[model samples]
Target: MTRSESVRRAGIENKPSSAEMDNIYYTAQQLDTKLLSASIIGWE
Candidate 1:
């Protein structure tokens, strides 16, 4: 959780769009469909 919006405050806001988020949340682990897919794995 170290890397979040807070950490990205220094750099660019690297996050998927609202529609993309819906797809990611809906789809399985089949990410990377987009050129810059925002696929994240949560162990916790």
Candidate 2:
């Protein structure tokens, strides 16, 4: 499977699994960090 597909599958498998195993949440946080960095650069 593709990387995105794997991540999606991991998300599905993570729900109702446990907070410690939430790949989607971690991925979203990482994405947020990148977005924040981009926005900061745009402001400069």
Candidate 3:
């Protein structure tokens, strides 16, 4: 399923607190950086 669909299915439409948003953004950024690094390293 698409990300939006997954979020909708999980019922995350309710507004999240600033701290929650911050944490989510932080985690996403970290994951993105790690993925980029892994790609650069050409790892399996």
| Highest-scoring model, lDDT | 3
Q: What is the lDDT of candidate 1?
A: 0.63
> Tens-digit lDDT track for model 2 on 1-44?
88768878778542345665587689889999999999989943
Instruction: After superposing candidate 2 on the true structure, give the runs of residues whose Cα lies further than 4 Å from its correct spot.
Output: 1-16, 19-21
| 1 against 2, candidate with superior TM-score | 2
TM-score of each: 0.34, 0.49, 0.64
Clashes of 2: 0
Please provide, for model 1 over 1-44, each residue's C-alpha lDDT reduced to its tens digit, 9 standing for 90 to 100.
46676668778677889999988886744543442353334322
Candidate 3 TM-score, C-alpha based: 0.64
**How many clashes in each structure?**
0, 0, 0
Evaluated against the true structure, the overall lDDT of model 3 is: 0.91
**Which whole-number lDDT from 0 to 100 does residue 8 have in model 3?**
88
Error of 1 at 44 (Å): 21
Query: What's the lDDT for residue 19 in model 1?
Result: 95
